[model samples]
Target: MTPPAESCPALVLNADFRPLSYFPLSLWPWQEAVKAVFLDRVNIVAEYDRHVRSPSFEMALPSVISLKEFVPASRRPAFTRFNVFLRDKFTCQYCAVRFPTHELTFDHVIPRAHGGRTTWTNVVTACSACNLRKGSKNLRECGMELKKTTRQPTTIELQLNGRAFPPNFLHESWRDFLYWDSELDPW
Candidate 1:
């Protein structure tokens, strides 16, 4: 069965040909991608086999698109739950175990009860068990050790970490743009 247009999202890249974001695997819905094409805001680097048509015209859904102008990245990554998880590589800093986003939680290295402020310097990704065990106590009190020191992550640091997690769905057309420099099999 043919998938719906909604399933056909286009991977969006900056003018430099790099993806706008890696962790989220920057993508735009088919409708927005088509609109961008019409507005000349982006160039279709690759396209899907499926096509959309109106009374006036028809065009293949864009599988990949690149911006006409470069978009600069922010110097500092946002201080959000997701970014915290990404900065820690989705691993519990205390136990050093990887978890799915749903299973992970962020914890204050220095518990708020001890005058810890909720900032990048004090927060770290943690598992539910560790968070519970360390609740309202400093790491020393809980006998827990951090896998790494907590600090604000640079945008580049987060971007590099984001590359470690590729989206589950990668269209064939996107592979070239995403992993062009990856080692290839001799055979």
Candidate 2:
């Protein structure tokens, strides 16, 4: 039986067959995939067993699709809460322990009240405990120090860091494109 449209998202890839983005695992809705197929914007690399039909045509839902043209990634990664955590690899800069996103918070190395601005250089990821401990105080006043100096990470750096944390849901077709660089473990 054909699955619902919502269940048939297509993993989108670049013309080179590499995923467009790794962190979020680029995907497109079945409708968009089908539209792209009709428009010649993307080539269907794989398909689901499910089929969608219209008055004149019927086609299988794409499971994986690749663009006809390559889209380059931005050179500069955006400075956002998520990017900040990713830049730090979700590790507390002060305590140097890895924490899940939920347990992590952004901290200013120099307290904002002390004239700190929320830029890539001034922000660091901290665990809840560390955040509260260092609350609104300068690093020296809190007697805490960052393991590494925070700075704006390049797009490539962010991409590398993002690879360490994969999305929770990965369709089987996406594995080959996503993990092409990883070495297989010996049995």
Least well predicted 10-residue stretch by lDDT in candidate 2 = 173-182
What TM-score quantifies how close candidate 1 is to the native fold?
Answer: 0.95
Top lDDT model: 1
Give Cα distance to truth, residue 37, candidate 1, Å.
0.7
Which regions of candidate 1 are displaced past 4 Å? Answer: 184-187
The sequence of per-residue lDDT tens digits that candidate 2 reaches over residues 42-153 is 9998888889988998998999999999998889988899999989999999999999889999998888998999999999999999999999999888899899998999
Candidate 2: residue pairs that collide: none
Candidate 1 local lDDT, 63-151, one digit each (tens):
99999999999998889999999999999998999999999998988788889899999999999999999999887888989988888
Cα RMSDs of all predictions? 2.1, 2.4
Error of 1 at 166 (Å): 1.0
Best by TM-score: 1
